[model samples]
Target: MFPKPIEKSSRSTQLTYQALLPVALLLWLAPLIAVALFAIRPSVDFTVGNYWGMPSSFEFFENFAQVFNSSMPRYILNSFMITIPTVIGAVALSAMAGFALGVYKFKANLLLFFMFIAGNFVPFQILMVPVRDLTLDMGLYNTKTGLILFHVAFQTGFCTLFMRNFIKALPFELIEAARVEGIREWQIFWYVVLPLMKPALAALSVLIFTFIWNDYFWAIVLTQGENAQPVTAGITSFNAQFRAMYHLMSAGSLVAALPPVAMFFLMQKHFIAGLTLGAVK
Candidate 1:
């Protein structure tokens, strides 16, 4: 059974919830607050192990400027290059594949759908060595294309699961109507199904963009340097040989996090609708 809404709670329960809300909120935001404070602190504070303490001097602008002045901009661009292509490639392929699995009737359809779902359950760590060697053999190691391809492939299974369910929830009568009116299957999908899938597509795009952008493990495993490394891994560029630039790394981290945050906010409406499409009725 679900917990009742706060509005339905007794007066004492309401008071207790209200009293604890701010504390819970602060606890959730504690790490983010620490990171922000770290970004504004001068380098000396970190050198002297003054973490969790107030900054001796605020150097917010200077720290962020240093990050931009370094190869951070290149890494940001690389993130966009890799993230955008992967999102597009994964979503597009999944759309077609989902249509087939969700719309058509075939003996192997359920098996293929299960296979895609199974891929999601496989531990990614197991594929690390083989995936790296595969890129090397294909002459794509340390290349953005390689990273993009790998992300697309890895993401497709989850995306297919998302899209196929969304497609299945759509009224099958629409497809029948289109067929009766003499529209080709491709035309029906492109004009009818794709248009109706905007909410789902927007939702999936934001999700995939966030996942690919925040990926540091694959970034380090599959690519190297500013040419191919995304901002997530490139944040390590702040580390020097003798010491770590914690302040600069903090600034870089905040900068790297902005795009995905902005993406979610901008597409918030469609994302919510897409997710809740079949939850009701």
Candidate 2:
């Protein structure tokens, strides 16, 4: 039912795969390569239609420096403010909810879990209008708090799914033993289950951080300007009234991408472990 492993493939097949890998890699990275090249080029290069050609002059430091010299710093701080709170709130709530749903055997357990899963399948575009209206009604439209709250609510469903499954895979005997030893339910959860959940928590934190950090749609829709807008939306400020600063935008894009990339690298081991923890029998 599955294709043979590359190691088990015929010698010719292996050789062909190796030959095409670099080409495929380059093709996949073409847009990124183009953006990087554009980020280093002078505005005159783009003005003279020298795109995809040699840069007339390298302005790497100038382009990157201009990005930081703008209101990009405020936007980045806004991202951290919004994303960190959303991550903590969503993960915390989901962990508790997942523990309850996974540990308890309530009559409506499956129904409730299904409800959380259902929200994830719904197209978020449809909610944009109502969400915007709701935010406006609550006077939170264009505020970091509103963005953080919305992200936490929106992401909780998926986070619960991830946490519930991970918690479910945990040993039931530990809970039973804890109970027999007169450990209170909260204590069992806080002291016993919580420690074991570190890997899953770390993984989910990294995932959610990346999601909220890279979020452009809701960032633009829910917030505006450098005061509340995340770096993703704030990058658009590079567009001037008369002309677009493509080089500055490209540099800003690269800078905006760093936190999530750094986060993933830092938590790479835990992320992989959390994902693969319950996979094996």
Candidate 3:
């Protein structure tokens, strides 16, 4: 039922595929390439409406230097403060919940799992008003703690679904063997299940890290100014009352994208392993 492989396609089809590949690649990278180009251009280029043309002079180092010297650094730090704690909390809670749901046979187990899955289908926009109100009432509005807690709660539903499916795909014999060996339930989970979940954990961490790091909607919705704003929201600080600094905004965008990219490369092997492990028989 699979489509014919490209290599096995007709000669004309193969030629067309080869010709279109680079064009598609360029189209995909167009925005990113434009951003990178803008980041290196002098601010005068934007003021003179010279966008989409070659820069008159390059200010590569100067632009990035200005970004770092501004409140961008604090925004980066705030992003880390919010994202790291959310990752740890969401993954930890999901792993335990996944194990219980996947390994045990309770009457409401499927119902509970479905609830988690259903939450993922609900758009976050609908919850925005109530969530913001709740944060305000709890005196957490405009605080990093508020953002962290909200992210963890919202992200856990998806994380639990991921972990639960991964755990279910694991061999059940391992748990039975541990139990037969007189191991306690907690010991079995600690020593046996947790070790096997490493690949999934690594993959999930990278995904969640990218999600929270790139989050702009919630960042703007819940926070304002440099004190609690993440890089995504803080990038707008490049705008003045009457003028928008496109060059600096592009530079800040580039800088803000680096951490998650670095994280994926660092965990590349584990991330791939986690995704592909259960795909084969």
Candidate 4:
């Protein structure tokens, strides 16, 4: 909807558009398609002489076996360790902050809300030094906890903006009726607001999971090795070891990409709902 749809053009123009679609898609997916194809290609067949020829033998099992038996398992575990805690902490903090800003009419409400909104847009480098120092000072440097804390704090800025707007759009009458029933502030939040936040929670879970899972910068800055490094950093090390092993690298990339992909597939509905919540008037 960002760009207005084009009306039916001339037959020649339509033909041109149809012709370009496949070319565009192929261009976009060329790298992935090449990787997928290479994953099944025998190393002999993948020689420069036959890179695109019909694979002489499918080696997907062999490549996947190597990847599985390699550092991928530890990386997967690390990614989950970092992603899950960050998602929970960011969502939980944002939910509470969003409730206060959405429900209260304090003079600083908008100011605080905009502060979070603006924070999300700032360059991450500005906070890197301070955040890393804080993590080190806490003795969480080079640990999963360090990565989780930074992710939670950084992601909370965006999540708070999202949840605040989402909560604001809910009917005020619901809170009013609950108030009339003599519900305390915490009870109103727990019973009336939190229950209705299911869709928002699901949506954010998928989004944050993918973001944290794919994170590279903070992972490198905070974590050192397989002990605490997530898949992105793990992949960097993998790439170094397997410099000439394209098939293994491809398989590793696919494995690294699978979790977020699965999460999106599983929570597609909630994700879409959260994203589109404010699209309509």
Candidate 5:
């Protein structure tokens, strides 16, 4: 059962909750706040061992300019190249697979669906070595295509699960009506089902975009340089051999965070609708 609403709690409990909420919120935002502060602080501040003190001077524009003038832009472009294609490919394949599994009643349907779901359970770290070798063998190592293919394949499982459940929740009567109207299955899928699946597609797009954009482990494992490396990996370029450029790294981190944050805000309405679509009776 759900916990009682805060409004229904005793006055003392309500006051306590209200008092603790902002404190908790600030605690959660503390790291991000620190990073933002570091991004604007002059390098001399860190050199003088002033980690927590007020910035000696703000170099916000200068730091971001340095990040942009470097290969950070190329890294961002590489991320977009890998992530966008992966999102489209995974979503397309999963939508078709989900339709088959959810709309049709076949002997092997559950088995196939279970296989897709099973892949999601397997630890990705376990496959890293094998995937790297396989990519090399296929002559795809250290390439955007290689990363895009891997992401699409791995993400398809979760996308399939999401799509299958969303499609399943849709009214079967719609499919029946289309069939009764002499609509071909593919036509029904394209014209009827695909239109209804917009919310799920939007939600899945945002999720996959975030996942692939923020990926650092695979980026480092597979690619070596800015030619194909994502912003997550490219951020390391800010580091010097003798010393880490924490200020530039912080600026890069903030810059790297912008796209996903913008994406979520832009799609906020659709994302919320997709999540809550089936909640009501």
Candidate 6:
């Protein structure tokens, strides 16, 4: 509707548009395609100056095996260690906060909501030093819990904004009915509103999964070494260890990027629904 339907365009314009679609897709996916192809290529291919040629040998399994046997698995485990707890903590906290903002009429409700909305857009670096110091003070520095806690707090800001708007858009009569029935506040939130938030939850879960998975800066600032480093940080180490080993590096990159990509594909319906929840209004 925004651009007008293609059938409304001239025939020559339609032909040009159709022809450009594949080219645009290829351009967009070129980096990912190269990485996937390189992941299956033999290590020697880099040394032989055949970066773009057909693989002399497909060593996908071998490379995958090597990565698994190395610190990659540990990196993955650390990634999960940070990602899952953050997802639960952020989503849970935001659900409560969002419900409060959406349903209540406190003096500072709008102000607090705007604070969250604003905080969500701030650069992570701005909070890096204080967050790191707080982690150190709590004796959680360089630990998975520290990273998880920070992620949970920081991510809650955005999730609360998203969920608040989403919850606000729902019918209020249901809430009024629940209140008339003498439902306690918390029970109303838990029973009446939470069930209707499945789409928002799914979308936020996938989105937060991708955010935490691809996180690198906080991983570096909060944790120092392999003891707590996630895969995104670990990939930098892998790059250093495997100089000129593009095949292995590409493989590691793909592996590191897989979970979030898989999550996007699987939860795409809910993701789109949540994103577009308030766009129409």
**Best lDDT among the predictions, by candidate number:** 6
Model 4, residue pairs in steric clash = none
| Cα RMSD of predicted structure 3 | 3.0
Shift of residue 167 alpha carbon in model 1, Å:
0.7
For each candidate in turn, the TM-score is 0.89, 0.89, 0.87, 0.90, 0.90, 0.92
Task: Tell me the lDDT of candidate 3.
Answer: 0.87
Model 2 local distance difference test score: 0.87
Q: How accurate locally is residue 184 in candidate 6, as Cα lDDT from 0 to 100?
A: 98
Give per-residue CA lDDT, model 6, range 143-260, as digits (tens): 9999999999999998998899989989999999999999999999999999999888988887888888999999999997788999999988988888789888888888888898
Point out the worst 10-residue segment of candidate 4 by lDDT: 1-10
When summed lDDT is taken over every stretch of 10 residues in candidate 5, the lowest stretch is: 272-281
> Which digits, one per residue and each the tens of the lDDT, describe model 1 over residues 1-281?
37879889899999999999999999999998788888999999988999877789999999988888888889899999999999999999999999999898999999999899899779889999999999999999999999999999988998888889899989999999999999999998999899998877888888889889999999999998878899888877645521477788778889988998898799887556545533543
Q: What's the lDDT for residue 166 in model 1?
A: 90
Between prediction 2 and prediction 5, which has the larger lDDT? 5
1-281, model 3: which lDDT tens digit per residue?
A: 37878889889999999999999999999989998999899989988999988899999999899888888899999999999999999999999998999899999999999999899789889999999999999999999999999999888888888888888988999999999999999897789999999978988888888889999999988989889999888877644511477788788888998998898899887556544533542
Residue ranges of candidate 1 with Cα displaced over 4 Å:
1-16, 47-54, 269-281
Q: lDDT per residue, candidate 2, 1-281, as tens digits? A: 36768878889999999999999999999999889988999998878888888788889999988888888888889999999999999999999989999998999999999888888678879889999999999999999998998899988998888889889989999999999999999999999999999988998888888889999999989988878999888877645521466888788888888898898888887656545533542
Question: lDDT at 227 for candidate 2?
Answer: 81
How many clashes in each candidate? 0, 0, 0, 0, 0, 0
